[model samples]
Target: VKSLEDFYDMEGFRDKEFDKDDKGTWVVSSKIAIQKDDSSPLVSKNIYLFFNKNNNKATGKFVLSKIYEDFSKNTENEYRIAYSNNKIELLDNAPKEVELFLKDYKFLVEEKSFKSLNNLPKISSRHNDNLPLYSINYLIKQDNEINKWLQQKYKFMKQDAIMNIENSGELSNSSLSNFYFKVRYKGKKEEIQYFRESINFKPSKGGY
Candidate 1:
């Protein structure tokens, strides 16, 4: 298996150029470009795929680092994937995984089954100081309610509640500590919340 360092140093990975100080945690671009009207524009996009080297897991922090509408004008537009931890959320559409889940398990859950849970309250605070104090009661209750509804409707085996936790490194300044969620269907053996200390969430009104 390739190491994380190898992945980071892979060919075609170029450091992103941004004006702001917050240049993202990790970013890289491709050398390919699209051409238009006698000019070779930087039309090709750069995608940053973040993964856990130790656990060999992927995260939702994938970003389109650079985009160009015209080669003559250096108008680079960056687009981000609507993210949760395990899911790649869309801007105006539901997540592809969620949609697949609905389609495959139509016998298990309806397409609109989770519509109500969609309105559940999200983590509103951006500071870790408020997480412990901030109530997850409503969120848990809502999830449980959905689980119960699914059980009643489909009579499928109900599994233990599984949650995604971001794990950070021991050193505060280590860039490798930037970890996100990994999905495991079996049990909560590795479900310990890791970076709950540094993370601050701004929950969306709808899906996040």
Candidate 2:
């Protein structure tokens, strides 16, 4: 198995700039500018990829990180179309073991299905905190009832519920909502975008 250190030292990444995190994980990043003509402005993009040495031998996938666009809004974008088909990069010089962890920082969850490789911590593990449980309840409720229940429960918990906890916007509704909760654990906190099929929600609670 190739270690992360070896990967960084590889030819492709040897010249790239990077930094180490507190956990010893490395973030390899780069900035690139492309220009087709002097008349057309240059297009610049920043690419980031995180590399963490796997502590376990089990194969896993990278958890979804930050998403930048609304695929629901730009359904016809050719880029979106390419990603949707997973025709992007299956033949890249990537390791099968690597396919288990650390998603390509350039791609979004909407572009591909990495569900089989996902290895996020369980949200229910921190039941004593009550926040995650409330979050589940919040996600489970139908109609606008989630707001009232969350408001009263949050007060009892002596804490205010924060929406878009991770700025993921995964928990938003068509209308404004007063009830929102943040899921925090082991000093890590974020409103993760749970898979819709994995959640227990009423299929036809409201008019579709």
Once fitted onto the true fold, the runs of candidate 2 whose alpha carbons sit more than 4 angstroms away are: 1-22, 54-208
lDDT of 1 by residue, 1-208 (tens): 1222233222221123322332132321112122332323323332233432233332332222223344345554333433233333333344453344323222111122335534554433232443222223223232365445444543322553332334332323333323332111222332111101122111121122
What is model 1's C-alpha RMSD? Answer: 20.2
lDDT of 1: 0.30
Error of 2 at 29 (Å): 1.6
Clashes by residue pair, model 1: none
lDDT of each: 0.30, 0.25
Q: After superposition, how far is residue 116 of candidate 1 from its true place, in Å?
A: 54
> lDDT by residue for model 2 over 1-208, one digit each (tens)?
1232332222221112223321122333322233333333333333333333232111112222222243343211111101112222222344453343223423222222323212322333223232223233222211223223333422112232222212111233321111222321111132221111111111111110
Q: In angstroms, give how far residue 80 of model 2 lies from its true place.
A: 12
Clashes of 1: 0
Q: Model 1, which residues run further than 4 Å from truth? A: 1-32, 54-57, 60-72, 82-208
TM-score against truth, every candidate? 0.22, 0.19
